[model samples]
Each structure stands twice: as C-alpha cells, then as structure tokens.
Target: MPNLRDHATLHFIVLIWGFTAILGKLITIPAVELVFYRTLIAAILLGFVLVQRRQPFRLSTGAGLKMLGTGMLISAHWILFFASANVSTVSVCLAGMATATLWTSILDPLINWRRIAPFEVFIGLVIIVGLYVVFRFEFDHAVGLVLALVSAMLAALFTVINGRLIKKHNHTVITFYEMAGACLGCILFFPFYVRYFFPKRGLVLVPDAAIDWVYIGILAMVCTVYAYTVAVKLMTKFSPFAINLTVNLEPVYGILLAFLIFGDAEKMTTGFYIGTLIILLAVLAYPYLNKYFEDTKNAWKDRRAEKRAEKQALEKQNTTNQDPALETIKVNR
Candidate 1:
C-alpha cells in the first residue's frame, strides 16, 4: 500500500488535473486552436522525454495506427471540454464530466464481455436524475452541459480503448502518438473549421497574447505530460480501485477551484449544487456498494456450506448408530 506521502502526491496530481479547465478558461484562444497547440506541444515534449530515456520509438504498425486513431478522439474530447467551459460556467461543464466514470463502467462490461453490474445501472439512473435537476435549474447552460456530456462519452471511449492498447504499447509512446494524432486531427479539421465554424478569421494560428503562451505551456508540459507521467508512476504503489475513487473527486476540486478563482462568475443555482452533490455521492458510493454486495454474497455462501456439512454429519451419525444385530444380519447375508 502507498504511504502518506504517496497518497498526498496522488491527490496533488489530481489537483493539477482539476486545474486544467481553469487553464482552458484562462487561455484566450478558441477551443479548436487551443487543443491544437496543447496537443502539439505535449507531443513534442513527450517525444523529447522518450529520446532522453532512450526508449525505442517503434511499435507494431497496426498498434501505432490504433493509437493515432484514438488520439483523434482525445482531441475531440478536449475541444469539446474547453468549448464547454468557454461557452458556459465551469460548474456546468464539470457537472457533465462528473458522469465519465459511469460511462466507463457501462462501456467496460459491454466491451469486455462481462455482465454489467447492477450497481452501475442504479448509479447511472441516480446520475441522470441529478443531471435532470441541474438542467431544470440551470437551463440556460444546457448547450454547454450537453457538449460536456458528449465530451465525457468520448472520454470514456478513449479510456476503454487506451486500457487495451496500454497493455501492448508503452504508455508514453502511446500518448506521444495520440498527441500527434490529436494535432493532426486539428490540422485536418482546419479546413472545415474555416468553412463553417470560423468563416471570418479561419484558424487563430498563433496566440496574440503573451499570457496565452504561458498558460498553454503550463497546460501542455505540466498538466498534460507531467501529471500523466506521475500518475502512471503512482499506479505502481496504489490499487486501481483507490486511484478511481480518488479521481472521482476531480469535479469537486474543479468546481470549488472555479468558485474560488472566478468568484461570483462561477456561482450557480442552489439546485445546481444539490444536483451536482447527488451525482458525486452516487459516483463515490459505487466502490463501497460493490464491496458490500460481494461480502454479503460470500457470507451467504459460507453459511450454506456450514449447514451442508452439518447435515452430512447428522446422516453419518445415524448410519453409524445402527443396531449391532441388524449390522450382523446384513453382514451374514
């Protein structure tokens, strides 16, 4: 098990991840352009790390291609993520993203040929009800919430794909290609972006503000690359269950940070907070529920086994207690 320092470090890394949305809001570039640069810079830095470590820069062609394809999903997820924040309050964006784990829970069983846990389905419904309450109160931020929900879905899918790919490929190499792929996706998207989304100025190819560069650099190097590397390293000392439980706190951290940083701008309706709280509670409750059911099931099995042993023992006692004359008669026959 991880000691106090390891756990603290894990939380710190998660805190950094939570700050990502804030960074997105701080950067002045459009979401599409922002993702382009974030991916590009992260890719370059990851590449440099690989070189410094003297890691082989090779993979089976098919795996490399798969990573690249998954990278496109990563790009889309981030574009939508930042766009959601840019368009509406961070509260709405994070509230939607709060369901990503539920999405993963659902997707994992379906993809891996396992039964969907009943608890997952119940938690999903609870989350939906929470979302409904939020949408009812914060109706104006509906578009942003919807965008964030879609982003969460994509995030879930990318995670599931990565789960498999990581078993075969080095995580850094996978990330490097995915980042490159994400950048390539942005480049490919520029034409359509110019045609439909940003007809006026096309792509905002460069950051106009110097502060934007600083934020982008922090986003790429610190948040994207460094946080991921550290998290992966921490995995050696922590269980997946522990890691996931802690990660569920990301939305909480992000929302609170947003409120502290943005003050009144980040405030939402009371109902919104209630809804978000409900969703969070359900998400956090899952592991405990799973353990509870598993333990109960084991208990029942143990009780049944004891009862079975007692019954067999009683039957043996009855057989051994047979009269001696009857036993002798049977033996003579």
Candidate 2:
C-alpha cells in the first residue's frame, strides 16, 4: 500500500488531470494548437528536470525511436481528448473517456501475452452498454464520441507500453523522451491540421482574447507537465492497475468541477446522469476486483513456497543421515 503522502499526491495529480477539461474549454486556441503548446512546454520542462536530476538524457537508438513513437500516440490521444471536450460538453467527453479501463482489458492480454479474464470481459461489456446509452441519447455528438473512444484506445496502448519501459529506466527519462516525441508530432502535424482541418472548415487557430494565455499556462504547466510527472513517479510505488483505477476518478472530479465552474451550461438530462453514474460505478469497482485477485494470487504463491521449504528440510535430513553411514564405512575400510 502507498503511504498517506503518496495517496494525497496521487489524488492531487488526478485532480489536475480532471481539471484539464476545464482548462481546454477556457483556452481560446484550437485543439491542435493547444496540444502543440502543451507538448512543447512539457518537453521543455521535462528536459530541465532531467538535467537537474543528473539522469542520462540519452537513450539507445531503438529505445529512443520507440519512446518517440509512444509519445506521438500520446500526442494523438491528447489532441482527440481536447477536441472531444470542444465538440461536446465536458461531461460527455469525460464519460466517453471512462471506457479506458475497458480498452486496457482488451489490450493488455494482446500486448503482454496474458490470458484474458472472463469477468473483466463481462464488466467491459457492461461499460459498453453504458456507453451505448450515452451515444443513443447524444447522437448529435457522434464525431466527438468517436474521437474520445479513439483517445481512450491510444491512452491504453501507451500506458501498457510505458509499464514495460518504466522497469528499465527512470520515470523522468521515460517522460522526457515521450514528451520530445509528442512535441515532434505536434510540429509535424501543425501545417496539416491548420490547412486541412481548420481553414478548410473555416475555423481559426488564434483566439482573439489575451486572457487565453493564462488558461494555456495552467493547462501546460499544472495539468500536463506537473500532473504527468507526479503520476509517473507514483508508478514506482503503485501497481499500474492501482494507478489507473485512481485516475479513473478524473471524470468524476472533472464532471463536478465542470458543474461548479460552468454551472447551468454543464448540466445534462436525467439519462445522461444515469449513464455517467453507471460508468463511474465501473471505475470505482475495478480496484476492488483487482485487489481481490492480487491477494488470491499472493496467497497461493505463499502456500507453494511453504511446501517447497518443507520438502527441502526433509531432503537435508536424509542427506545428513547418509553422510554419517558413509563415514562409518570409510572407518571400517
């Protein structure tokens, strides 16, 4: 179990993650531009932190390329995440994102060579039903919902990839490379996003208001950089499931914060609330199920170890008796 301070820090990081939606809404820039700024700022900040910590800032060629690829996926996820918020209400965006666990269940076995759990599949199907309810009611926001689902899949993919990388490297180093890749992806996509996605549709990248800078700063600094760093650090102490389960609260925190900040604009129909409730319930249920299975696995391992130790003790006693007889034979000879 994590210490109290760790628990506090974990919640704080999740809170920042939850607030990202509000910041996305408050910022005036387009999702592509905003994500571009976010990745650039995060990469810069992580670079400085890596230097300060005196960790090796370089990686092997293959590893470096892999990290960058992972970062690009993350960049895509963030872009879609923010775009979802822009096209739909924050509540709907977050509710859609709550399917990340379901994505993980389907992805982990395929990625990590593990057997799929039937219960996980059943629960995941339940979550899909919840999503179907939301989609049926919010059919007008179909594009945004699809974007959010894609984002969740991307998020799950990189998350599983990161779990393997974190074992061999420091969290900061891993983050720096990923952030660098995200920056590169944003820059590469900038011209295309502007020319094709924006102007072709007659949308603007630059917001008219000066106050947008403050929101961008909060989104980049507090939410992206700080929250991501803290979460990475926490992974050293917590299991991936534990960390993700905690992060699952992002929607709840975001939904409440959206209501508090945006008030009447954030309110939804009774069906929407019911669907959100079902999704959140799944998020809350994951930790308990994970804990139960983990504990069961540990207990089984302990029993096996005890039996092995007992067998070793009996073998040693037999060896000791045989040694005395062998000594007697040597003396008689």
Query: Which ten-residue region of model 2 has the weakest summed lDDT?
Result: 199-208
TM, every model: 0.88, 0.88
Best prediction by lDDT: 1
Q: Residue-pair clashes per candidate, as listed?
A: 0, 0
After superposing candidate 2, which stretches have Cα over 4 Å from the reference? 1-6, 200-205, 232-242, 304-333
Candidate 1, residue 304: lDDT:
100
Among residues 3 or more apart in sequence or in different chains, the pairs in candidate 2 whose N, CA or C atoms overlap within 3 Å are none
Candidate 1 per-residue lDDT over residues 1-333, each given as its tens digit: 799999999999989988999999988889999999999999999999999999997988888889889999999999999999999988889999998978888889988888887888999999999999999999999999999999999999999999998888888899999999999999999899999987988778677889899999999999999999999999999988899889889999999999999999998999999999999999899877877887898999999999999999999988788777788999999
Count backbone overlaps in model 1: 0
| RMSD in Å for all candidates | 3.8, 3.1
